[model samples]
Target chain A: MTSASPLSRLPPGPLLVLGYGNPGRLDDGLGPAFCEALRLRLGGDAHRAGPHRMTIRDAFQLNVEDAAEVADHDCVVFVDATLPGPGTFSFEPVTPSTRRAEFTTHSATPAGIMGLARDLLGADTQGYALGIRGGEFGGFGERLSPVARCHLALALDHFTALLPRQEGRPTVCATPIRGEGVHHD
Target chain B: MNPVLQTDTERIVIEPVTRVEGHGKVTIHRDAEGRVAQARLHIVEFRGFERFIQGRPYWEMPVAVQRLCGICPVSHHLCAAKAVDLLVGGESLTPTAEKIRRLMHYGQFFQSHALHFFHLASPDLLFGFDADPVDRNVLGVAAAHPELARQGILMRKWGQEIIQATAGKKVHGTGAIPGGVNRSLTREERDTLRAPVSHMLTWAREALELARGYTLENLPDVGHFGDFESNYLALVRADGAMDIYDGELRAIDPRGEILLQEPDSQRYLDVIAEEVRPWSYMKFPYLKPLGPEEGWYRVGPLARVNACDFIDTPEAEEARQEFKGLAGGGPVHHTMAYHWARMIELLHCAEVIQRLLDDDDLLGAELRTEGPRRRREGVGILEAPRGTLFHHYRVGDDDLVTRCNLIVSTTSNNEGMNRSVTQVAKQRMEGVDRITEGMMNEVEVAIRAYDPCLSCATHALGQMPLIVELVDEGGDVLDRRARSGGS
Candidate 1:
């Protein structure tokens, strides 16, 4: 199977991990830290040795560029810290639309930074959204919520699955809860 | 529920209301040494346009945002288009789109700058504050200097015509799209613009000479008064072109020191903070680097002049020469010379608009990208007639906007203008417990010089009375006056 036109031209790369969260808040740093952890696990040697430069892209304050970057890469993994709602990590593979307004940095959100990434990347970009529970927000600290720490391992397992694999031409994994019809698994 | 309430004073209590385009009053006890009393500016109507616009479709964002102000809607439209272009990457439109956009803005510049100068500020310049307040308006100016008044109206009207032709609508237009404009200009429309351009230039000279007739050495006392100073900021191209519509943000000190030049708009969140006053609907915007209490900076004409070293055109350069003379020397920091800076801008706006009308691409019909606008969440920032305006939004999957944030000039200049008011109130007020209506009106006039869009400044207003009162030391009320008429 194949995607036509613009979607067919998604960036050809080995591994792309996208971290989306507000750096100014406390636990939101979970997204960036997850990317850092993955970096430490894979090491720069792996990215440099590979064909593309998909090390880490942190959208501290997400803007339109978040979508553009994702569209330009292959095998993209999205990471973010979720707000403390159900006291659990919602690990879901999501597909999102390229519409700029669907994703946001604030409230009542369905589509997220990861969804934006998938929308831009098309089939060339394999995307996932991993969020840890957030307890204290608005303050300056990079620690996860108590409930999120428990599910950190689950997030890592999902994250690692995509990094080890090659750019599978047609990769579909999990149902996207927050994603628009732009991307589907 | 009242944002502005009275506090203790020596004898009377005063409640002041601040606004988007202008300032107000709250007076109390005087200095320990005894000069003027405590006065607070209550920004009565703050239209949290930034907050109100959340969740709107991206395409319509600019149109709605442009309505936020009557003075600089043109700039708002252009800025919105510029912002959307960043995401759309219609770089295919490049220099042509860029130049045409600039030309459209020139039309805005011509119209708005003229209105502020001739219709609003010119009355003050031609007639003294001491000149019977009843007859001291545009009508009075027409009755007095008929030719100048007529010419002023014509010049401003021509500006409106330019905008109408370019955007398909006059006051608030979304003609500028991501790829380019939604419409094109034909030769006939362009041809009609020629006479107005010549007519405005001739009238601009007459207006300048009229202003020059009242030199600083012998001018009305108020026009010659003022010494307060604050930092200035604006946008400038890397090559030094005037960046009023699409340039990097820059800030400079009164001494011409480059405090900040070509700063990133994205980083504006880091360096700038919006201050709120519950009394008035307007929000005060301050430089974040200076801290909440300390970062008070001025925007608009006086600030614009103080921000840039020179005007963009040769005619404006000559007008700048006259501006220096009006100040009796260096940068005129007085609230009064906001009039002078305004006139200079009017002259420049006309000249620039003329230059754009001479451009070839403005006639091109190809405007939009035929491509469905995919980007939904975007920010549109521009220098409006008052100051900086921001339109931010989030879209839903269906391309319908979900949320929005609109930060207009009224909000951006709120803090500093409020601070500036305290100075003027002190300068004009004599007794803390017996403030007069004229004194309050004087303060209000000081604000109208900016000609802020009250609708944009105050999201809501149902005949809010303009009240002036005198208060005592214990913040007790003494004498109070409220009127509906602005002038």
Candidate 2:
């Protein structure tokens, strides 16, 4: 690839992703771990993770504004594990500014957060946050259990059925913000 | 009968303006020969929040009151969380958690600020009321500045996502659970935030540059925030960062007098007293030490700028310099300058959010800690895009909330905005002959400069019509006003 290629122009720019939290806490650090898997799938070239043609961050960082920032872009597939929610898995588009309470964390409802982002970015952006249900929620579980790990470890072949008959990044997740919960200080 | 021009000596009144967050009115009278003599702005909402939350669960208080607004939820989330954090006995949260909270707030800033610029105030900046209703809105902005409109929306998403993932949701933010949060992030997700965060930083700078190049307000433009000299208020970390979280409640006058810097945000009533009038539902708040006559203040961008010494991030600093250069000082007190301040904050939010990603602790495992068993009553405060927001609640022994109080951004600056409107009217329209719809729109935009979300401000349901009116000396109406929205 030529040095002038768009893909080669990263690393020097501002950081696009930084997954924080303790991986030992089970679902806590599933963010970075998910990206690591995605990174590998992309052959370290974020674009290879399916046809969406994204870096690891470009692949995920799912916010309405993220779409606008990359004008020529299409979709974002975020991957993360949630602790002790419903058994198995669930998928839904996030809205803006709505907040939901977790056992240990006080977060805005994914709906409200993304909805607000949509309001800000308007027609320029659109994306989704994918959450992985985790077995280890309380205290410290130290590692992704079999179920959660399997979810993160799934290959591209598995993702094909999730979206549709598409090659490049398939546009997804268009929903309004809906959620409500109190955040304790 | 006197000539039409001579009727300026008659007394007139406008009960309430329409399509705004809170209640307010305009009174105009002719002194002698029929020109407008005296005009005043009155607030009508009272202090329901302080009176209701005397005994409530401190932890649940913030969220309970957060129902106050569909817009600017993060401000209440931060303020309430910080106040309760102060009430509860606990060490500071992990830096990672703090950054997460700040990052979410920045997201709030991006969305709220952008909303103010686009959805609420952009029409006046770009098109007058004369602009076709069908194409005057986002369409017009898209036509005029598509790139800016695009950036504004996307940046908001990044901020909201950071908060949403951390708290499980974004608005009515439930992320800052007492003792610590109830959730932890996955490493991969943290990495994902990097790209959007970085992209936002670049775009935010572009936003700042664009904002610097254009003045968001004109004395006679539609959807414009006019200039007004008033007291400014906001909270700031001792380090002078862009404080949306915890800090003493400080008030500064136009001359920069530190009127009050109470360590407790709940003590807002002591330092601040709200005034209600027959004309409007929105309350006017002024320093208790200084009566309404002496209490003219402002909030939002200009207020935050005046109240804070400097911004926390680098791009914000550059934007801050440009802001100073615009109004000829370290920061601005003019309400219109809020447009500039809002963009600067958007840039800061993007930059600070990225810097937060660099922290390895974000990728660490230790995030939440169980709280010691207890029930407490408290209030939280944060500067929403509009102004200060207070969420107070009372929970019983069983951990169920029994009472709630919401002192939203509109309430915090009700008194200030009322005074601000009168000042703006006097300065921008008093001596003018042609007071067309576009001119009146400028007056309305001044109130919108605070980006008041009446739904959240009053915790009131429905898109009720908020009214503002101008009255003459003979108790006759001169101009009755309501916003000409999407319709």
The per-model DockQ list reads 0.01, 0.13
Model 2 docking grade: incorrect
Write one digit per residue (lDDT tens) for candidate 1, span B126-205. 66544555555554655577566556656655766677777765556667886677777788988898766787877776
Error of 1 at B340 (Å): 1.2
Interface RMSD of each: 21.0, 12.8
lDDT of 2 by residue, A102-182 (tens): 000012233433443344344223334555556665654446555556555442223323433234644222321111010
Model 1 lDDT, residue A101, Cα: 36
Model 1: lDDT of residue B139 = 48
* Highest DockQ scorer: 2
Instruction: Looking at model 2 chain B, report the run of 10 residues with the lowest lDDT sum.
Output: B459-468
- Per-residue lDDT tens digits of candidate 1, residues A1-185? 11122132224565566676644355676676566555555553465454455556554434322444555566565667876676455545456543323422111122433443343233346655566666667564445554444545456544454443346522323332121211112
